[model samples]
Target: MRLLSFVAVFLFSFSLAEVGFAEENGSSVSEERLTPEELDYLVNEVGNTQEESEDLPVEVSRRLIEEEAQVIDSGSGFMVIYDPEVTKPGQISTFASIAATTLKLGGTVYKVKSDRSKDDKFYIYGNFQWLKTPSYTLVDKMTIGFPSSSGLYLPTSGGKVKQHQHRYSQDQQGNGRWIDYTIKYSPSNWEPSAGVAGSYDIRASTSKTKHKGYIGQYVYVPTSKNGKINIKITYGHRRIAGTPSVSVYPAGLSITPTTATDTRSYALTLSY
Candidate 1:
């Protein structure tokens, strides 16, 4: 006749104190320490659930006990597990709960910060540690100034094309002239798919153009004379990924008269 055994496991919540001992050779023992709350949650919740299981074979019951002990021993304070899918600020708290549960189950959790801004924040609970994502600048904001002239001068030496400002006629009633400009990006020995290559914003007169996605050749017409073009370019890196360098080169510009025989001159300056 087969023998059936019922396993009764009792879990008591208590503070886990730091314990250290020396081996026979005098080597110190190092182990992960769990907070009181984490220990209480793990034992009262996880252990009690397992204890409620009904009778099973003696071997199966023994195996289950061993497995539970192994799960409790696997947690580490030094190691972190990163989940890149959790990238948004709204998902931080929800993910933190999942991370805490994972930690209780002898798993690891990594703290991650959103890339939106320095002021944007999130927290990881199980580890009870704060981690900050390092900031890196891929492209510095630069401004190109031009003297008042009737013609636009486009640069001949720049990398792949990213943006283009076409020469277009403005309203005859306005004193503005069209300035043709181009923006290009060149990666420094890195794949373009590694991270965001770059982004740019162009502000001229009363108009503002922002580019956050897609790097491609495009034309824009901003009517301005003796006005400034404010340009700011930024690059973002993937979570936990090291900094990658890139260059944003504002190519030269081409000038065209708004109207035939219109000799009105204007100075165009670009700043970020």
Candidate 2:
């Protein structure tokens, strides 16, 4: 009797499998209508399929992730990059960073009273930087000067030096003319009562490399015994460090001397 029972159970399972197989392989059972057993089989099979899909891992593409995580421009010569990774709902984290190099120039330029009339002086004050941009190297020459009408003069003012002017050239190529390049100027919130202070953008295209940057602190007639003046200038990037350097004549002499520091920030004081 036990052997007969086992045989009966095995036959029942085999019959159910055969029925499912026939239904899938275009058996004519559907020409009329599904029998109760057939309906039950179909429902259970569909439920199992849905459960399998829900358990499977979702596939994500790398390109899509890169597109979603993008860089945003601050529009003020700065940039911010954002990266996000989402593992599951409510389990997301984002990474953000600033560019290695950025263009920013700021500082003060004004005039202070002096004990002597010939000592009336102008000061170039401020912090300026080219950051990590290659423009520092591409730009071959630079100049800073007051307009002829300003009457302000560099310490080395000579018969040829109409106004206060400073210049730097790369590879000893000599000073370049301002009219040879593209210029851009920005409105500055820093307004000085004694001298004119503003932001200037200079760019040049000579060879394969492109160069551009901002004037950090500029004072047109920064000091005045008597005159309205404007300052225009350029700067050269140091060969080894790729930092900016300015030429100035301090002793009211014709010899222009390079600054004592790097393109990093510095204070300029003018005393009469």
Per-candidate TM-scores read: 0.16, 0.26
Residues 83-156 of candidate 1: C-alpha lDDT, one tens digit per residue: 23334565543444333111011111111222334222111011111121112112211112122231222212
Give the count of colliding residue pairs in each prediction: 5, 9
| Model 1 stretches astray by more than 4 angstroms | 1-94, 97-131, 134-154, 158-225, 239-272
TM-score of 2: 0.26
Clashing pairs in 1: 152-255, 153-253, 154-252, 154-253, 155-252
* Candidate 2, 154-207: lDDT as tens digits: 332232221121211111122221121222232121111322222223233333
**Candidate 2 local Cα displacement, residue 248, angstroms:** 17
Best by TM-score: 2
